[model samples]
Target: MCPTSPSASIFGINTVHRMSLQSALIGFLISRMLPTPLTPQQIIVVQTTAVATGTMPLAAGFVGILPALGLLSEERDGTPPIHLTWLSAVGWSCSVAFFGVFLSPPLRKQVIIEEQLAFPSGTATAQLISVLHKLPPPDTSIRSRRGYLHLDTEDDSAEPTGRSPSSPQPIDTETDADINEREFVQHEGWHALTYSFLASSIMTLIAYFFPILFSIPLFGNYLAKEWLWTFTPSLSYVGQGIIMGFPTAVSMNLGMLVGWAVLSPLSKSQGWAPGAVGDMTNGARGWILWTSLAIMCADSVVSLFPVVYEYFSDLYRAQILRRGDSSSKEDHEVETEDRLVPYTWVTAGLLISIFVGTILVWVVFGNEGIKPWATVLGFILGGMLSVLGVRALGETDLNPVSGLGKISQLFFAWIQPGNVVANIIAGGVAEAGAQQAGDLMQDLKTGHLCKASPRAQFLGQMIGSSVSILVTATAYSLYTRAYPIPGPSFPAPTAYVWLSLARLLRDGQLPEKSGVFMFAFAIVFGLVSASKTYAARRQSPIAKWIPSGVAFAIGFLNTPSFSLARLVGGIMDYVYRTRYARDGNDISLIVVASGFVLGEGVISVVSLVLRTFGVGVISCWGCGHGLCGGCPAV
Candidate 1:
């Protein structure tokens, strides 16, 4: 049977149908007024391009570009030299052409399930449905069939079972037949306008202003350094949460922080030889090639262990452990077992893609002169380090660039003067990893919601990612051309090279410094803390240590302001999770939080649109043109 549509019920409600139609129309109109509405396909295309071009944060280019053009004052000492005219014309033209060709074909695709996918939880759409229907609170019981609370029913069997209960029974068709007929003629003009305006306004204001408020004291500096000077399309963490869901968004941010702020800086400090560092950072063509071969070897060896175990388990289950004819309950269990098969396939596909992608990269960028043996060794070492790094630091949410920076600084300390290239490549790889992981999560979400084939979703993602590669390449080229931030002046590159050189001089290979060791130690500490907190009460000694450890790490890595910001975020997270999360009627709270995230995206998009049109909302402090003098004309 086909999956039920969320809007079907609304159509059954005469009043709701009328209201929805009106709202959609009004939304359509308002969207036209603000900026051209890009369809989902168009958005996909744009996103791909943005990511490829390293313009994932769209604001980064504009921020830098504007300052260079004397439109906005230089906020920092180092601004990339960007050729605006060329970048703008090329980027916009490509974006327009790609969208026109690709999105137009799928413009009419109906949104059967338009809500953002939620993982480990359900989609936001499910949450909205539960809220609107006033479903019962979620039951924590493991065996309950309904994962969430359901309305009280007289039947005992209908009570919470904890696994997701069978899809809620379909509503009777006849119940709303008469109402639907009577409401076919009703108009909902004002209601539509109100909702659309409300959605847009609420989203816009929150996204734009809330971050500014949150960044007031400590976060202010980091925010300024990372976002203010450049067009970072994915700058707003909240927006990421809303669109991609919280976990994915948070993970991406974590990766970025680790790569950019933590790993890169440390690598540069170690100062491996300039030549070695250069090779590592500047494409590390040799290293990547060797790494791929090493991975293949390791993968081959590891496959045997899992394959043998699976083979034995299957044999035992089918032979000695086999029972008599399976009953209905056993049959049901067998059917449910199939659910896990899809996840396995998805994982396998991802690994294959990674291998293929690495090969392609190596072929395109590798050095011909590097011997296969050295490359292989480098690859093995890099892979080993990556694994260890992940184990020690936890899977970084920071950009891969930072991670690469760390690796280059440490291992290729002998390869000097290429720290800048290393940092950029590292950052790019980190970002790509984030995008890949996020894409997978999103695919999983869609699969869960629609029961769409995982294979299908994976295929779609592959297609989507292919498009992204083109977009990324184009965007990067244009951005580099327009806002050319010289490598020498870029803070990240300078710091990275400096540190990497130092480490090399001091310890030969990147010294396993106290900081690196400490980082690994922190991972163990985090694991222990998590276990203790879960086992003990909320206020247990272990729980106390968790926060202190986190604080210490923050202090070690960041400035006072950053530490302060984290503290504030922690307090807010605590309050929301404890207080708001518990309230049965607090659905609006999630929306509010989501609003903040959505607001960030909207503001970013809007700011970009304005800039594209030569309108500057932000201006220099002392440009003497009254309010109008310095600001870019709208």
Candidate 2:
């Protein structure tokens, strides 16, 4: 049987109580299991539990189960056991211990430099602190050469009458202390925990439940046709615009339209129907699989180049400039500042590693047996498309799997119409999963600030996500069993290999409109790329124009209602940010938002549980509606 779901209670009371219980349990278990006292580093290892257990475990479980069930692999009707073994538990425990020990020294050094030294903010550690607690603004004044020179005289005498006239008065310690205390009270401790929990819960709930709501009538049907109309003159839309910074959201929505609605439908109409070109015996599907993998690999390689360049530049600058200086002790002293890894480098490395690992797994495990040349070409195309994908959607701060999935969908649509629908669904699931993981990160950040064990947070996420799996799997199974997609409808990739061959046959013509379209598309793409670069360098007006243009294009292309929903979300986000900014960070709004998110997530879990028991209820409509028929009538 699956693990028992946590007892439902009100946010503050239930959560705090449950956490306290869990913490005690962990402490007790550690004392009984371990032979020695855990070092500070080992203590920190607990944090990994937060990641390991949540979405990661859920994802792993899904991957494991899917292949066994024939939904994902050749194996059929096999069920993996769900028992938690002794060896597995020990491995997890050791991993947590090692992570804490390895991370502590750096973390400790950061705390001292950042907290005690009173250094200026904006460093990685500082940002973490700020997110964890309220921090005073950075000191913006430049240290003048003359001021440094005169510092000795000021220190030598209580009253230095000969000090430079331009020297600014020293800060009043008492007043500064009072201000710092107030800031700390406002940002750190319980307040930070509250905000983190709220933000994470809300984001998670929305990611999980929005798709379900999107399927309901009036709202779902309307948004699927007229996306923009839903958001016209709406405050929520305006708010969303402000919070997401307009450009990113607009671009992402436009991408969805171009990929899903337009390309998908067009592919089907071009004689790319299933079973028309090749039989399963010809190994046609293997070619498409290899093609997709190649694209993913190329994209990963392109993404890594920037990171390598940045690292080398930093190494050169450090070794050649400051330490290499001859003949000046003073200059050497001034140059010997702490080394740091730039945020850009970290971001790039993370993206490249994730995509590369994913592609490797797919290529090695996938059933496809395409040619080496085709794989290489696919990789190059995937990499080229990566740039376009980023511009189209903005940065997700989530997993790159969904982005790659989208690229696959677009490419497959060009090759075979029958694969379009399956690709879209896959993209959606991958994206949604990443979004859920991101929500967990927000929570983990909060937990980090609050001195909560990272391991605990990881465990919490695993527990939470595992709950989702049980619910989602059962619901999906029942729903599909009750109302499977009919014949002639899309077969969801597994049902047909002929779809790919049909696409190849239809597009086999050499001197066709497709080629013409490709040339024109290339030109348009070059113009956009050039424009974006200029905007980045010069902060040109086009920076605003392009995203807006994309948004307008999407408004025309997609259902007005879906666009309307996005606009509504944007507007609400804008207002929330504005209000929070004005109130000087009350933390209450964050809590309220978190409540909404948690409520939504909890409801989803409930729905899933009910479905597993064979109880059916009408799902709620979109964000605008709170409750309909999903909840049992009192």
Candidate 3:
């Protein structure tokens, strides 16, 4: 669930790490596939529908299948220490996906409707939907800002069609190719997005063969002389920044500053951190992983106190204080299904997830490796952290999943110190939960603006997650079976984190005892965060500049240069948005951004598929090197 934490409309989709962008493109292609060329409005509905079913589940599998496979893949005692059927893995993943669907409604209320988080991608999708449908405005104004999302006013009579409910778009048989293309640009702004997709894909293809030649700075080269160690100049990072916007971008950068720019250099100078010899990147990684983990774990606990207290306090006010709202019912009414998915289905899904999850954990990890109570705690944290993840997404469109997952991993470690598999699976659930929730909301936001059927969106989510479980599991299994892992073909980067941790724990290698000081520092930062929460509750203006604890933690998840790229993108977006946002019709820039992102994703997908199937996407004449470490038998 690689939610881009995006904002710059079109480009954000490609910046996302998962297949969400594919859903958008696929939907667009579906329109093309139709005998009659549909307008962008119709295509958006198609896109939203496809995304609901496609993106969520595919990304969600990392949580479900990866953990079981991770444990199964581990060669303990000269063979896999634990055993479980592939069906069990699929079942575990499905159950988690279902839990996501179950949990969405409550979260939608608490985070979206109540808290009014930005949900940048969601907001952009809504705008995009408007453009697609060419909806008429209700004399609306966008109070665009950083942090929170505000739908300044609700046009009670407004629909996705941008027309009164009684009106309908005229059906036309006009079929001039030039007219169609111009109309596509006018309505959906697809042309710019298409061009970007083509350009980036071409560059990606060129980079694949000639890593040295046509070497783009962002994707290929480091700054000056390998200064930052894997300082990738990627469009994805830039797109991410643009999508996340100013508040999130800046806060994340602050975190990056602390991790790489500040801490890494400080640690290196003191000669305290390892990886002193090889590259600067190593120091950055070591410090951030160590310090950020401590900070995030503490922050996770401290940040919750305010939210929980606020929730309860609200309940008390509603009950004892008897507080009441003055807004009219018409102002709040929505055309879509009030409850997107049925409570019955959610209950079933929750039960199944817990039941299957319990069986899977016990079967795979065994009694000694982990306790049942630990697994329960994992699911609980996963559930709770998912809310936090979704809330952050709504506010900043920035996914805090990696940071959240790391915290979950640490929590599991505390519960059962030595079991690496337990840590990984626990982290997986948290990550997956975040993905499912975020994916649903992203789709729903588009659906809401497009006035697509909520029930259809819900159904799409369920079906997509289910299908993805099977597809991801099968494909993963095939790839793993074909390639001896830590080899070409099946890199399984996610698996590496757990495997490495398991090895260290199994061999009794934990972080140094001095690392406890980091915990102390984390506590200080967390308490400060708690203080900020109190100030925010009082509506103090100063709280706005406090820098989000969650967003800061998110910064440590990626490298410094990547964070820098996002900041740059955010700045550019701000510049363009300031000029164009007034019209409410200025979507060409958004379209351009989208094109670039989609191109990157589509080309990457093609390249990945080709690589997996033992084919090279291109050939380099001077250098015989390919991404596959030169051609080998598949």
Who wins the lDDT comparison? 3
Worst 10 residues of 3 by lDDT: 1-10
- Write down the lDDT that model 3 would get: 0.53
The Cα error of candidate 2 at residue 118, in Å, is: 19
User: 63-106 in candidate 1: lDDT tens per residue?
Assistant: 22222222211232122222334434233223212211111111
* Model 1 lDDT, residue 469, Cα: 42
Candidate 3: list runs displaced more than 4 Å.
1-92, 106-124, 136-150, 153-184, 213-231, 246-258, 276-284, 298-305, 318-340, 360-377, 384-418, 445-451, 474-561, 564-568, 578-585, 613-634
Model 2 lDDT, full chain set? 0.32
Which of the numbered candidates is closest to the native, going by highest TM-score?
3
Q: What TM-score should be assigned to candidate 2? A: 0.42
* RMSD of each candidate relative to the true structure: 14.6, 13.9, 7.7
TM-score of each: 0.42, 0.42, 0.69
lDDT tens digits, residues 559-599, model 2? Answer: 33334445554445555667644343333333333333334
Question: Candidates ranked by lDDT, best first?
Answer: 3, 2, 1
Clashes of 2: 51
Q: Which regions in candidate 1 have their CA more than 4 angstroms from the true location?
A: 1-360, 368-439, 442-446, 470-545, 548-585, 605-619, 622-634
lDDT (tens digit, per residue) of candidate 3 on 300-352: 56655544454556567556534355342222325545635566766787777
